[model samples]
Target: MNQNYSKKCAPRRLMTVTALAAFLFAPASASLFAQAGAAASANSPAADSARSAARAADPLRGTPSTITSAGNEARTQQDAFERSHRLGLRFYNGGADATCEVALGRICYWNNNGDVPPPAERADARLEREALLEVLAKAQRENPKDDWVNGMRVRYAIEGGQAEVGLEAARACGGTDWWCAALQGLALHNLNRHVDASAAFGRALAAMPEAQRCAWDDLTLWLDPAMHANYKALGCSGRGAENARVFRLGQPLWMLPGNDLQNEWYSRFTMSRVHSLGRLPYDMQWGDDLLESQLRYGWPTAWSVQNGGAADPRPPQVVGHEPTPSYDFMAVPSGIGSPTQATAKDWEPTRKKARMRYSTRYAAGYGALPHQFARFLRGGDTTILAGGYRLMRDLEMGRAPYTAALTLDGFDGRAPLQVVRDSAPANSALLVPFSSTMLASVEVLAPVGKRAARVRNTVSPLPRETRLSDYLLLQRGDPSPTPTLERNATQAYGSTEIEGGTTIGIYWEMYRQASPSAPLQVSLRATRLGASFFQRLGSSIGLSKALTPVSIKYNDNGRPDGGAGRSLTLNFPSVPSGDYQLTLMVSGAGVTDSTTQVVRVNSGNK
Candidate 1:
């Protein structure tokens, strides 16, 4: 709930309280998908009218379905309509009329059906669903042009948490190809197949009318003001990262296969259009309140009566499928710098805090494994993204099937990035087309035991001519004196976190522009952060009381014409546990360059 949820809601009887909404799951339906299948034929007047309507003469489906089928088409439609009507009425258990009153942007005076009783538990819902689907399938075969029939078949399957069924229904649809594509997109989005879903949505948008496409393309419908404005100026038509960033990020908890947010957005669009034609529940205030309720927070997975007998918002709560961090939704992190740089603070916002709070963010259906990578200018204008990751979870004696994937979203248009997937290999190098300002999200996922970890961000391409590549940390125990991207992936730790008095390995490649074997002046230093006052004071002057900084300086020879670079196992057992900014600088042929990374050291006991 936002800051205005309590103040704006006037009537105590009807409150959009989280706990209340969480309890009541409203069960029933009141839409045309159940009854509005007009059973039209090619020459029928209804068919002609629907043909003229373009999108749909009337399109919708009622809640979860309790409609039945009869022997004849007309009788079946009538039976389904009557059954849904009864089911809708049963929402209040026995209400003759349910009243609606909108206030302060919420349902305020919902009191027509006096003393609203709790809705009865839904029973035989499966049987009712099968009957309704049978009728719709027959209707679909008979009148394939009716958009409602096609939409209901898919929507019902998706909402019921049956992804395969939803996909099949979407594919079997015959109305508008665009509509079918949109349906497929919805199903694919639910399954978290972002690339495929984006392709489907792209097809739908391509086939839609320009005006409709513009409406669908509007980011303002969901984004906060600041972000919306930012995206407005982005001119990013080729970026397909928006849906994954929004739907999954909006409710990342992978409890259900389908993304509730996507379906909710779809539902809102359908309701806005269909309700305008006047078939939905009347009570203008109720509609506004309900619409805003869904629009602002999210659509409810289910609704039910308040346990404490609250009268108003009557089925007094609307539970969201899952909550997104709305507090930060409206604006970017203030201290974060401009989005131009790959290393900007806003690039990977949740890293520091999340990694610190949780030992492993590999819970539920998602993960956050740590890894280090470096981009090298390979031949043929391709930048090779080389990295390795180590897993801390699912370390059983038996080797389980694992999939390590390097996914790069926003690759370009609807085409997916071509890369090989392996079963937890330590090190691999991928070649990608080079671009200076490419805002690509490169994710390295090597999940084990179904729960996996992934580290993703936009890495700026290496300069055309550079002195050295980024540091790749490795396990101090590894025997390989020279680090290669082809090492066993599970051997290196991505978390630069270490324990006090522990040694670790650092590896890097020297890109000597002059002679490959040129001798270079190399210096490595670890500066303690938040140093004690005495330590700072001691360092101000050259005195015996001053402590020697954790520093290592050496002269190193660069690699030969076709040689791999160099590495060192670093250990400072005397260095106290703290945060350190580890800097590596290399000077060769009078040109100097450097890179820095943060490494944390905890007490030995920890």
Candidate 2:
């Protein structure tokens, strides 16, 4: 769970090749949330006098001698780059005769890339699926000189619905089968398919052979460690080992290793011990680096295609107040053609130049609040003020606090999902008014009674635009057979509603996708609002970041630049008097969004 994600509470780069320093750690079954480890050594006092003179010249006093001469010069340049790119072992040519016709195991290209026909409603009373469809119809009537088990019996006769009997059984079974023409172009893309699954994954990537086109994109990222060692060496325990650990946690070489760990060295020794192995058996499969570089750098995290416009849409309600409880998937609406009418003089300056181009991509992902504000709640307490929570747990155990977490589930009604605090006395939650910009205030809390709670706020985003994969997507994970491709900028919840005296407000316009590959989650919800003319426009303006609590009952005690002020009074008689709620949860490096509001105590009350 430590792939060093930065970009906000970010900065991690430790990779000492030789003298060994690959500690990593973060995949131990997703480390049960709440994390902020590995990051406390900022050369203080010259690194405590160089670790007290390398611990008095070492006797293994925590291994020293200038850190073992910089880990033997990084293990002699990682053994001269693995002895100049070694490359010896290479066999599995016919892929163990296509894993002895699947009854055995090994040749795994995303799971047997073939064989699956006997289903026309179990073709008349199945007796072991009609003797395994009479041994796959006598291996397609003996057309087998084994070109990878007759290219898995022509991809199980074009996925069974037989595209012209799998192109007449691959033209009466051909010889140089490149998986029988990628199973007759994937049995004509399983019937209702697209120009044949794109001409069968593009003629299986043009029958490879152009020096194996980067070995078939490194064998499509070794489709999860050779399909979890050929489904546990074919015993297939009814698809066991927890279904090969969900196809090796959805493969991609668990985010950037290579040659599928030297052609399977026990799946790179189980991805070097899956972050110190934990999590009872699964959950976390190697931690962050944009999900282990999308499984060993194969990249492309997810894609489903076929978007004939609108299907699973409704989701686009971002504007203010969100203390959790949101999921809007861009709120649908793309019906495509027919609906033109412009011409009110070219639609009023093209709707003001498309509202200044979506407000400059929403102010390039938002600003304000860059460190200096802490008071966490919802279980593990942490408090800091104007540099609070003990300087934010000394920047979460030294440099890096925005750890990350926010989950809200399905609601029941009166909306306004709760978790608000700072009942006045200065715990500000968005006030802004003073004019020419810059008077910001945002506070969302939960503490005092904590009703059926499930909120996790680990702030830190003002640190010069946040990155390093947004601090390795906030650590905690493990269990590995290599396969990683995560993208959840943080915002997970399911059941909702938990009110408190309410008051809400928000104004955001952020965006950043100039080729963003992942990282985005912005959720915000809020209700309870009587506005009170926004407290008479925060006393006719002087917006000193809000907090005026004590005791003023003012129809006129006068201060907020007095000029045109009346009825408002709050001056901190030690502040904390009643009803509350506030929410905001923005994310990047997995993109996320959120907003919510509420706050009370007004009849000139204190």
Candidate 3:
């Protein structure tokens, strides 16, 4: 128990702080899904009245079940109300037309709740027709160059099989243009056109502005958890990317030199490219917790569209997940046993040491410290954690006689300290520092007995040439297991054979060692032609499916490893009877490399 430092806050101050916290770092709720089955309860007048009131307050939104018990009841209710309104605005007001907005809003609301309006009343259905048209018309009349508007128009055309119209619109709208370019890309894609679509999408990426990008970045970081989740649930990966393009419009943006964009940015960096970081459909506890904390306490103003919004305005959110070079020394203890070491795993120790990969990153800091620190982390001598989070406490360098206790909050509903390590007279193990202002640390129980393992620094200080894998992973979610086909490593990119209609599956991991958080993007395509050709063709054809787009965002508090790890799945329908090839890309923050596998398909299966 610590002393209360601040004066007692007024209800409004408390509300604002609580709201801010919810906005910055609220966790996603499993109960959100359960609400779907819990409709307005028309059978009860009181329940019906509550539902009607909710609808009036926010035409399309649902209440998140994950409420903080620590806060006052009024505060909690107020936070919930504000969050619901924000969701309504994000889904219903932020898009092309009322219908699309509402439909998306419905999806968002339903994501946490089971009840959804019928098809006729579905906002998505209406948006698919009228609202999209309105947006297109508005773009054409007022801001034809606006990429977002044009992009939607183009997409509607492609989906409606109006390939010619789509191409014209795309041609008229440059990639640097906002939604317009997205629309053109989508339209071109529908007509079995890949090259044009790729170019369109490329232009969109290239034309993006740094300032707009900055704003969008803010939105992703600060937007409410419920709102963010609803946005992702709308199958809006490409849309979000396209939106990001809108933000980055008019900026001399450059993607990794290779044909891949999704993989390059999202995967290499392990930052979520599609979904908002710390949003839903992601179940990891730490990520959720950290996100909640960020929402409540981090620099959310930075994430606001109006302000220099980023997830936080505070100094770079410290990564507590893993170890880095900033600290004098960091230690990570892992019990590596063979696949089936049976019960005698840790004890049946052979001399074989488990080779662990630590992901590392440096926050953009001014002066000599941050940059020098980055250099230090990359110097190949600094040891980092698996997903680049915590800096291990260096028992070797730090003064001894210090103890650290790990405390987990949610499970027991009490702040119980877990593991405590004490250093000898002159030295102590590594101490993990909390760095991210956007995320908070939930003290975890430190393991006992096992000597704190030394983190081996392996980053090479190589010249910064265009590393394809690195760039790709930076663009998308965390990469797959293996990167390029290095002769030394046993795992190499593989090949698969498929019939025309046969489905192919893709897999990968999203790891962030620091805050139990990592955002990711997953995409799969086949290059019957060369990579470039397929990319272009895919873009032109508007064949990219949002459902198939793989992107997982990291969270703050549950798992130290940013528990964004998962096996992504991609399925392809029957293609034309020709020799076809496939490419799958995954990316995220704190991820170093991406893995690719090629597969061939024949027409007989179709």
- Give TM-scores for every candidate, taking all chains together and pairing residue i with residue i: 0.62, 0.20, 0.21
Q: Which one is best on TM-score?
A: 1
Predict model 3's lDDT versus the native: 0.28
lDDT of 1 by residue, 200-309 (tens): 77788798777777666554545544465566665546323554455544332222234444444554454343233222222121234455544444332222322224
Best by lDDT: 1
Off by over 4 Å in 3: 1-152, 155-168, 174-198, 213-606
**Candidate 2 local lDDT, 263-318, one digit each (tens):** 22122212222222211111222233322322332211111111112442321110
After superposition on all CA atoms, how large is the RMSD of candidate 1? 10.9
Error of 3 at 239 (Å): 22
For model 3, residues 1-606, the per-residue Cα lDDT tens digits are: 011000100011011222222212111222211122233232358965874665435311213332122212323333343233223221111111111101111111001011121111234433444444444545544544443334444544543446687677666663344444444554544443445656655655555566544433333322224345544554523345433422221011111011222212221111111112222222221233333222212211101011112543322111111111111111111111111111111221111121111111111100110000011112233211111112124322223332232211121123222233343211111212221111111111122221222111112222223122211111112245333212111111112434454433332333333332443444444545433555555556776422122233333232333333333234456654444434445444644334443444456532
Reference-based TM-score, model 2:
0.20
In Å, residue 131's CA in model 2 sits off its true spot by 4.9
